[model samples]
Target: MGSGFSVLLPVYDGDSPEFLERSFDSVTVDQTRPPSEVVIVQDGPVRPELTRMLARLVDRSDVPVVLVEIPVNGGLARALDLGLERCSHEIVARQDADDISVPERFAVQVPIVEGGADVVGSAIEEFVVEGDGGLVRVPPVGHEEIERYARFRSPFNHPSVVYRRSAVRAVGGYEELPLMEDYWLFARMIHAGAWAENVVEPLVLYRVGAGAYARRGGTRLLQSEVELQRRMWRAGMTSFWSFSRNVAVRGVYRVTPEPVRRRAYRAAVRRDAEREAHTDQHTDQPGTTDAGQD
Candidate 1:
């Protein structure tokens, strides 16, 4: 039998209502082949309502939910490290407190890990919720398409990823880099010769809300990529052409205006929608496996 998986959910205080409920529901696995354990690492103090909700979740748990509370606030990397240390399983999956994974996320990802890829992930579906209660779902992406973007930007959705515990440990786990810890982790993995693959399915429902990180322009994001490039070079993991291409890509993003960047994001979503429509038309005409998730 394959190794059972453990989930490390890192939650900071203040969570959106939709986000909290969706996150909890995503991991509220059914009786069959449930997670071996779930380590909820509370990063800091939470609102009374959040506390009450967590308490209720604990009481209602048919499977074990271990809550690891920190006395004070820790940053994202530290919180993840703490939860990772607590996991007893070989497969450690990541989830944010404010996002939801599709039901078959682990079911689909686990076999890919078992099949020998150190890092296995899937496409993500992002939902931007307006303050006035409206929500928009970004269109879907395929695994290969995501990989192409991964070289320049973060193609793999961090919270929607599952990785082999050994590989994570081998690379010194996650680092406390600014802004793009997830991207840095991927760079480290690729640098260390750790193979990665993604299911062509959309396995996560990611929540996007107004936050400081989002408000900040592309400066921080671009800086992180520069640091990633340095790290990759130090690790002797760079091809000359690929490195130059990455630099050129960052140069373009750096020069683009913020409004233009936002427009580009929206355009990417529209293109994804068109691609999906095309695929659907082709699939509907013949016997095809709808191997998609949302």
Candidate 2:
């Protein structure tokens, strides 16, 4: 049977009430199949205005909203762990306070998860504060491709995902990790025999700007990349060379000039867009089923 749906949202003081309201609306009002309940985890203290906003959002929403608070700032992974345990459904759809999930996302992904898929995610359209930007797409589509992609980059977009709680719990509940908690969890799941699929379609609008670029790179992210890749190496997920190479490339990308890094990222996105367009041109051509975690 198809598992029930619940949203897992982790918020912090940094998440604005404006974004939170939009996020809540996207899941509860915009969605074709709003989650049975929305489990929001307050990672730490929030502003008084945010507190008022949350209270009002819950008061007006039809779907139940369960809010949990961490006494202190524990970060995304820990907050997610809290939300996961409180989730009343077997299928948990992840959403970020700053992202807007497409209305049909749950409708499209539910069947895939019901058909034995453990994890499912889709591409995203990135937006600035005004909601206009490029598409942010994950590179892999199936389990085989996903694992290989993992040796390099995260195989799925974290916010555009729905995962089976049992499959995730079987591997291990969310554990705090440096910058890449989602990637780490997926790697462990793949290691534990769980399967995943990427829908190859954009299902969320991700918010980002210059600040995101700055946050994504630099010395701190370099350290996290190195630490994460090394963990994969220890787990036998990658060779020493792959580990070293990933660290070097990512570190360089991080420390590179922002303009150059931006161009490179944009170029890659352009290429992906072109390739997808070309594939779509051949309407009858056989291609990946966009099915099977493989």
Candidate No. with top TM-score? 2
Clashes of each: 0, 0
lDDT of 1 by residue, 33-82 (tens): 45778888888898888887777777887667888898898788888888
Worst 10 residues of 1 by lDDT: 130-139
Off by over 4 Å in 1: 30-33, 129-150, 210-218, 239-248, 251-256, 268-294
Model 2, runs deviating above 4 Å: 129-133, 275-294
Instruction: For candidate 2, write residues 1-294 as lDDT tens digits.
Output: 345689999889989899899988999889887789999999889989999988998899999999998889988888998899999989899999988988898888878888888999987888886455566664566677677677788878889889999988996787777678898898889888888887877888898855876777777777777788889999998999998898888878888998888887878777765755554554335774432233
User: lDDT of each prediction vs. the true structure?
Assistant: 0.70, 0.83
